[model samples]
Target: MRVAACLMTLCIPAVSLLAAGCPDTGASYDDFAARYDKINPGTTVASGPSQCETPLGSDMEATGNWLFTLSVKLNPKKAFVLSAAVTAEMQDDGSMLVDMSLQPLSATDQTTPVCGATIEFTDLPVAPDGSFAWVLAPNETPLSLCGEANPISMSEILTGLQIAGTICGPADAPFACGTVTGIVEAPLPDFDLTGSSFTMQKALTDGSFPPPVLNCERAPADF
Candidate 1:
């Protein structure tokens, strides 16, 4: 009888735990699978409240209108120029978050460029120096908003993509502002753009798209 009573006590706690439900950690098997998908290097899962918080900057003062351009030195005509409305905000975790909306000013193929069709990336980090780099490799952090390209072979494309420049300027207002240059490394014989340059600038506007909003929302942890 004593043994059965002890077994019953243990089972009671297990049942209570099951009733309590899973912890609100904002982590799940689906989130893990989506984030670590083998096919897409830049696929991003929408963050839950526990995963990230709303950035600590204003919409108007913290946003800027910018332009981003990319090209391959091997084929100069195969290029794209996009006008981006950018916003940079400091998170409560002391990391900066950058969000951008890019529209193609000129594109070899509008459907298959750096950022695919819509260019909004949630929860991307930025450095204090206003510099960022997005590498196209699997399982890498600090991902760019780049989407899938239309299967341009390494031999045919003949060069690696490159981008470099000041994204968020060193000021407290009107976020992104700086001179940026784009270059495709020449003599890249082995399917690489070893020393290419990329950059961004303020875009000229005649009242086109609406201003971008800071998309991250923060929620306190239940634990």
Candidate 2:
């Protein structure tokens, strides 16, 4: 399988400012916009740059296991509620194919299979702090839209917010060339933490036409 790896980490507080129904100060977006300008730093907006091209396939591979450490503050004193590690197998078809056997650690101390839309190459980007930013969009399914399932995951609620973007790179590049990362935040819900980091180091492999066969026997049978 064609493999390319990217690393990400994000630290966020467990409280929800929006859930409490507070107005946004555009803090997150403003920070992102600042970084975007710093990287692109040009007057004309750098149109038609090779990095903006779509990936050849939908699968995204990883050179090593992707890890995330979440520290939650349960009370005003800032206590540790939980931490987790999620592993994904990059498929040739460009999906962040989940191992299924892997589960998320919980603040509630429950083990649940992490499922849903697969992570894509477009999802990773480098934040200001050099950590990998994992962006998630609100699921638009009938159940989700109807409030049957919460738009954001409970884990995400405890963590920081996610933002989505397009992956761009050379059209003829061997691997799907793009970036991915995450931003860290203070424990306070409404406050924006400065100096968050994101980093990415992709391991590119040769692309094959028919795609290589994946060893998915270890994945959950029901998935």
Candidate 3:
């Protein structure tokens, strides 16, 4: 399982602003555009390259057992929680080396299981204050979409996935990524997180680390 990790101590009072301009998931192209226009009001996706904003906003204590709750716009009822263990060490180079271990806290929504498989950080550069920012922009290779049930075997599902639309972010910084648009298949687009965010809080009551849960139903044996 491949997991993307983020290390930051952010407190976002303006979380609603984070959802603005992100691509719409689980909606048709026309609907996506309409909603995008409604939120942005006269802006265009093709306007230019937008920076991929980090969900990390303000600040909090860095090292702790955190309950990471990822909220997606598509399914508000679904749960996306991960147990995160963060360790920060001061490096000789005057930067902090941060590492995080993240695992599913329970049965998650279809998207969270695969996307939240692992969170790794090795010698990541950080500020003097131990805060960092990062965004997992879409890579050149499209990712395999997973679910609770596979139409066939997980391997088949992975190999057969078609390329879908791009997920965009903020604008005008090395922290962001360039934008691209494309047509996607039906049943809403895959890997869409338009107006979604990962919010984390210290698990004050749960001192024990979160245990790993079972893999998605019909998942590949190795997975």
TM-scores, each model vs. reference = 0.39, 0.26, 0.40
Clashing pairs in 1: 164-198
Q: Model 2, 1-223: lDDT tens per residue?
A: 1111221112111332112221232344344445544543551111201233344232232322222222221321111111112234443433443221112323232222233322222223232211222332111100011111111224233233332222222323322112212232322234332222211112223421211111111111110
Instruction: State the displacement of the C-alpha of residue 189, model 2, in Å, after optimal TM-score superposition.
Output: 3.2
Better of 1 and 3 by lDDT: 3
Which model, 1 or 2, shows the larger lDDT? Answer: 1
Clash numbers, per candidate: 1, 25, 6
Ranking by lDDT: 3, 1, 2
**Which residue pairs does candidate 3 place in steric collision?**
10-58, 11-58, 50-170, 51-170, 51-171, 52-176
Lowest summed lDDT window (length 10), candidate 3 = 156-165
lDDT of 2: 0.25
Candidate 1: list runs displaced more than 4 Å. Answer: 1-62, 75-79, 92-95, 108-116, 136-164, 168-190, 204-223
Our tally of clashes for model 1 stands at: 1
Span of 10 residues, lowest total lDDT, candidate 1: 1-10
lDDT digits (tens) for residues 1-223 of candidate 3: 1112323211111221111222222233344344444544444432311222332222223455655544334443343455667665655654455566655443333223443345343343344432233222222222222333222222211211111111111111111112122221223435444444333444444464232221111111111
Alpha-carbon deviation at 190 in model 2, angstroms: 1.7
